[model samples]
Target: MRFPSKKTWILLGLSIVVILISVSPLLKDGFPKNHDSELYMVWLSEFDEGIRDGQFLPRWVPNVWVGYGSPLFNFNQPLFFYLAEMFHLIGFSLVLSVKLTLILATCLAYLFMFVLSKQFFGRHAALLASSIYIMMPYHIGLMYERGAFSEYLAMAFAPLLFFVFYRLGQKISYKYFFWGSITVALLLLSHNISTLFYIPAVFLMVVLFSKKILNII
Candidate 1:
């Protein structure tokens, strides 16, 4: 069977440590138990039921809005609930699951920032970028106070999406295109408001980068 290499394990360990530190406030309370955090928990029932019934992707939340229901799965940012369910399946309490999802997103943001930066600058620059990212006040509020969980999930993918798009320009490959599209789609699914803001910047960057790539070539 295929397995993770030693270096992969080392990176995973280091990432876990960094992510835990980012959510250090959570360790004290075992994670926030109320506010906007609670609404996400209220939505988890459908996901839990869907998992057990083997109905893979949920389409509706049948018990929302005083039981009138909602097309939650149709419009909700899915990655948060999906990641939270994985943590739940692994036996964490629901609150902990949501918190862990945030931690996981932080880990990805750090890891991808490091990787993408290393390509442009070097290892030291990558470390600096990742450090700055986790240390930023906006990230702190998003995780600790604002409880902007879905947006956090989307943020992790946004940088990676841009990096993958840039890589596609350097080396034309179907693999790069496939992964790039998936990243863009994930960003779109992450948050409607965020996606609205992202679309214009994305199109502008594509045009600008395409021109730069052609000039360099």
Candidate 2:
């Protein structure tokens, strides 16, 4: 396999550094000590059972709210827990899976920011933007303190959605439209609440960016 160039390596190292500094508090020694973590484990325990019963696509988490379960799965964000469950299914422990998901989310956020920013701005600007994305105050709070895993994962897709939108605007073609639709779907699946807020931002970008919205409409 070919190795990355020195510049690639440097950017990658910067991404890792930004991610680590953002979540440094959680890495002090152990997992987060909080009610949310316990809730995650409980949800995963039931999720594992459903998977064992051949319910490959879980729509309702059967016992989450003190045994009086609602259709929480139907509305809850699936991407983060889906990843964590995949880890558990593949033999990693539940808690470790959650930690890994947070780290993976952090990495993907930086990488995606770098890609989207580089597409419009220069490499130096992209690196700076990606670093800022990593160290955003609310982002750090979510991963280190609040433990809102799925919402945190949603951050990476925000820029990617705009990037895909730019591509679709660049050419009124089938392929870009398809990919743009898929990106929107992924963002919605990751976190519906974030998607709701993203809608206006997307339209605002359409208005601001060289009037690209005209091409699509």
Candidate 3:
């Protein structure tokens, strides 16, 4: 007979709590709510412009006016744009389109964090780690705000990246290596700043835990 692990039960409980928090924001008529009115207005205007010019990437948006005169691109990733474009084509509200993507990304992040954390630590550690991640200050700060979707999505990728690395080290497979590299690249693409922040911390953790770190030249 199969029995659910304590970790599984903890995750199930946390999942319910997170769902409630996420749905609470949707009790209103639209995305961003009145609390983040300016944030939504900015993204909505950019969505209109992107549709007018027919670009999948948010190129030189006037309202998201931070990257002007700099070679540095919009911190936002193309995946969100791609997802939003498809929703726009389907006649969904721009606000709803972005919200939907954000919600999915957020949920995936939680799920991945649990799975990944469990790979290294047991179920108890995994559930606790995942709970911390979902309640992270950065996520809470930027989750509903506009133009920060890339960071939010990339946040989820970080756990998956670690999980893949942990599995690769366990099995020592070339295919895992390839997939791990791809995950890292995607993280960089989504949010270079986050990659920058995560890379050092991840590297330090890896060095401390990975015996192979000393085996490599």
Per-candidate local distance difference test: 0.77, 0.78, 0.69
RMSD of each: 4.0, 2.7, 4.4
The 10-residue segment of model 2 with minimum total lDDT is 208-217
**What are the clash counts of all predictions, listed in order?**
0, 0, 0
Better of 1 and 2 by TM-score: 2
Candidate 3 pairs with clashing backbones: none
TM-score of each: 0.81, 0.87, 0.73
Candidate rank order under TM-score: 2, 1, 3
Q: Pick the candidate with the highest lDDT.
A: 2
Error (Å) of candidate 1 at residue 86 is 1.8
Instruction: Report how far off residue 2 is in candidate 3 (Å).
Output: 8.9
lDDT of 1 at 120: 82
| Candidate 1 C-alpha lDDT tens digits along 95-140 | 8888778777887888888877887886667777887787688877
Q: Tell how far residue 90 is off in model 3, in angstroms.
A: 2.9
Error of 3 at 156 (Å): 1.1
User: What pairs collide in candidate 1?
Assistant: none
